[model samples]
Target: MIIKSPFTELANARQTPPSLVSEYDSCVDLIGCTSGQDGAHQAPGSQLAAKPHCMLALPGARNALTNAALAAYERYQMGQPDPRQLIDVLRFNVFYAFAHNAKVLGFNDDWLKYEAISPFGAPQPSPPSQPIAASCPANMKPTVLQMTVEHHPWIDFLPCPRMRDNFLRQVRDKGEDAVDEDGLCVDIVDAASARDPESVCLVTWGKPWVLSEWEVTEPFMKKWAWLLEGCTELMESTNTWRRKRGLHDIHFVH
Candidate 1:
């Protein structure tokens, strides 16, 4: 069965006002997620956690994409292996620093797992213009778009430690005037746009065990809904743009 994405239709519509909590709640229910569940039908103790190949996504954070990237690490700590693909379903207000976070500690080589071009200067393949199947055979890997490549700059400085190190080296080599006097700030923003919806759309799906083991607070729930709305808008805008360009629309399937 094809799983319709709850988020693929908001790109062209006006963003729901933040004060519209009731509207947001209704929208979440429409998407098959209630207040505390990952999916509409996902129960207290299902088997999504036991699957060997797990999918994880992290929404970029405004204050710190680094902290948001740790969402994947935290999942790994809970026993799921590092996800093979990291998707940005929404625009980010900050640099793709989450790439650096994914490389934290001993996971340095983990960035190599994804199929997209490394922002660290690796060669880039053609951006995906077709609908990437979310299932195996067609969905083994996530799709990449030109916009995604253009928008996400983490590959240049975040994952490539040398890239960042080189920048610092340049700063020292060129002297403080290079940055301070030049008034240069290294800011990176991924493809997601502020005009689109949420600032960052980071999220992941876990099995019931993982969800059950996790703690949920009221504050976290409110934030979660807000973020979910952002993801929806991003997906909608992405697919709508793709369709307008005569490309296949994107979708996610469980």
Candidate 2:
């Protein structure tokens, strides 16, 4: 089955040069392909696309939700958990993408779960929810959709207990990369601050994912008047710089 993001036209690549998949961890790995942006190959199929893989909402990409769905399909074409098994997501915010992508991939309810997790400067997930797929209990809140990511899959909340305790703590640690002064959070977890941007990501969720700044915002730090007060921006850029270098974007689309 070929699940393509509603946007991005890497379908030609799969038939031509194909792409590469690197081991992301013991249970997961990274798949790379060409995209519309200045990135590598784009696997637009939602079923095949794991988080961190990104697709551009280029002029054609804005075709409602299907463009993102195409990105998921690219990932699906590569392969997945085979629907009858577990799809390991160590720190994935599996909300809108999981639900919509699961539906697209023919996944039933049992195939997904909101597993508990904890990573550095990140927070443990819910007893009832994680990101996209909601818990079964009737009392639980159902899933919601957003463009910005609360945490990249590389962000392991299981290691960072202290930061998850407070929303602000998460903001101070991990949310810096994604959050902006206008309250829009973009999920550009560059190498520098990628170590911990949990809170920052959450605050900026529900907005478009931007590489740097958009028409309404400037580079994240520039939007924050206090960036110069303590030079936290420069400090974080230095620390996070190395991590974003070889990084690739995965689309957990809807």
What TM-score against the true fold does each predicted structure earn? Answer: 0.21, 0.22
lDDT string, candidate 1, 142-233, tens digits? 22322232222233323222223333343345442332211112112333222222222222121111111111222222332322232333
User: The CA-based lDDT of model 2 is what?
Assistant: 0.25
| CA error at residue 187 for candidate 2, angstroms | 6.5
* Per-model tally of clashing residue pairs: 12, 67
Local distance difference test, per candidate? 0.27, 0.25
Give me the runs in candidate 2 sitting further than 4 Å from their true place: 1-22, 25-66, 69-166, 169-218, 221-254
CA lDDT for candidate 1? 0.27
Model 2 compared with the native: what TM-score? 0.22
Candidate maximizing lDDT? 1
lDDT of 2 by residue, 1-254 (tens): 12222111222233222332222111122121122222221212112222342222122322323333334444556653222111111012222333333343223443222231122112533332234344322211222211122433322211111111222332345553322311221233211112221212211111112111111112222323232233332234323321233332222211
